[model samples]
Target: MRRLIKLGLGSLLLLALIWVPTSSTEATAQSQVSEIPNVYRGCWFQPEILKYRVRMTATTFTFGGGYYEQKHWQPIKQQTYRLSDQVTAGTFTWSRSTNTQGYHTIKVRGGAYHVKVSQGTLFVKQIRQGHDINGYELTFNQISHAAQVLSGDVH
Candidate 1:
């Protein structure tokens, strides 16, 4: 009787410990979402053009593309950009300058390039090889059509 009571109490205590952490983690996640900038958080990449979709999330940002060249989706190399809290509004551009000789290469990169973001509009300009790429202006609306595609809401 006493042993049974102790066992039940121990089980309840263990359950409470687990439940507390889980609930706390969930609450913390919810709070972060509220604080996060209202931006697209999902897999996005351009398929028609060689230019890949740049993705940003709470923890990381990645730019890459997939090609179905040989009957398989092959993932291209991606560049990761780190974000700082100081970044308030602007377009972030990224580029790499590489010097290659005989299959050896060195890469120099820049990113989080400031542009401007207003009213949920992201305007991006392209820079290639230390020169601005001509006639290339990329824009993304905050309410993306990509989400519909991802959710199978689009045909």
Candidate 2:
């Protein structure tokens, strides 16, 4: 009779362990959207005022012109830009132009470019140009969600 009682207790403990994770996971998934609000709600890039800068480079290229964003051409002003780890250091070139009338084109090198931003997620495109090889694009995302998992904010 003692052996049977022990077996029943073990079974209950096992069930509890299994059920805890499944229920917590559901709760975590439901709360993820509420954590970040309207992160992807607008036109991410404003080409008219292309504010940007580069660091740890020999030379700097400024975009003193107008560009296109969402079918409109607007003036671009130079500003300081920050780069994440995803941006590789090397020869990089970027151009901005509108796909409509009154378009503007601006190009720059020796700096990083902002590729995409969505759902509180940001991506920086890195470029490396060489002989017989032009360049390549690399995308990066935030891993802070992993920290939330450790803190019990996510399961």
Candidate 3:
């Protein structure tokens, strides 16, 4: 009887150990829209891709290309303007049930883009036809806002 009781307690402990990680991971993976209300609504420019700039609003995403000079980014015309909808309410998670990175998906123009926010930085990846293509990732930092202000691209 004592051995059976010990085995039961061990099984209970194992179950608890298994349960704790899953719950916390799910919570982390399921990011709320409120957590990133205005983080994405601005213009983004990358130095590596100096000829291009991206702008985001509450309901639209725009991509344009031009040149950067004297701490300013100039876009001659909006190349691709797409109506975008934010996937709120934790609608999607990529890879593995235990994954803990939270991101937002902007569906537009026959594909989607994933925007991940970490420490006030935006990491964006473009997915075309359900596959993540190479050389289609962007990283935005504090300098992006400075450039936006300088270029008058604030929204």
Candidate 4:
């Protein structure tokens, strides 16, 4: 009878050892989107201003990804326009069930914008400010590759 009891207890401990780690790992992965939003990294471009690159991550929005390591937008025809003195960051909330739809907001020192992105396509709904352009409906598409920065005006 004692042997039977000990065997049962050992089996329960073994089950707990296996179950705890598995559950914790699952929980961490599922909550990663909410905890850290800066996982989306890529180069995006606007049609009117194709020369300037917008590199967006889950955390920060870099206006001139190529021209300047700093944040600014340099159009092909226009001069270098500052986005913010400080770095501009972004945040998006994703649901556990859906990855197709999400809300993205970017707040820079000079400008702020809110967008809704679906399937890698961003629809700009509110453009509070921009270095050159302001308050317009715009859509940014993800480019297949990154662009090279040809010229820049250093601060």
Candidate whose lDDT is highest? 3
Q: Compose the digit string of candidate 4's lDDT tens values, residues 49-119.
A: 33545555544445542242234434443212222323334333322233233545544435554555567
Q: Per-residue CA lDDT of candidate 3, range 1-155, in tens?
A: 99999999999999999999999887765443222246676766554534456666654566656765555555677554434123333222222121244756665546666777678677777788888775666776545356555554664
Top model number, TM-score: 3
| Full ranking by lDDT | 3, 4, 1, 2
Q: Where is the poorest 10-residue window by lDDT in model 4?
A: 77-86
Question: Each model's TM-score?
Answer: 0.38, 0.24, 0.50, 0.39
From the highest TM-score down, the ranking of the candidates is: 3, 4, 1, 2
Off by over 4 Å in 3: 1-36, 49-51, 69-73, 76-100, 142-155
- Off by more than 4 A, model 2: 35-155
Pairs of colliding residues, candidate 1? 91-115, 91-116
Per-residue alpha-carbon lDDT of model 1 for 10-74, expressed as tens digits? 99999999999999997875453222133434444444555355566654455556444433334
Give the per-residue Cα lDDT of candidate 2 at 25. Answer: 93
Q: Quantify how close model 3 is to the true structure by its C-alpha RMSD in Å.
A: 12.3
Candidate 4 regions exceeding 4 Å error are 1-40, 64-102, 129-133, 148-155
Candidate 2, residues 1-155, lDDT tens digits: the string is 99999999999999999999999998886443221123322222211233222111212222223443443334455342222212234222322333233222112244334343445443334332421122542222333332343234555
Better of 2 and 4 by lDDT: 4
- Clash counts per candidate, in order, are 2, 3, 0, 3
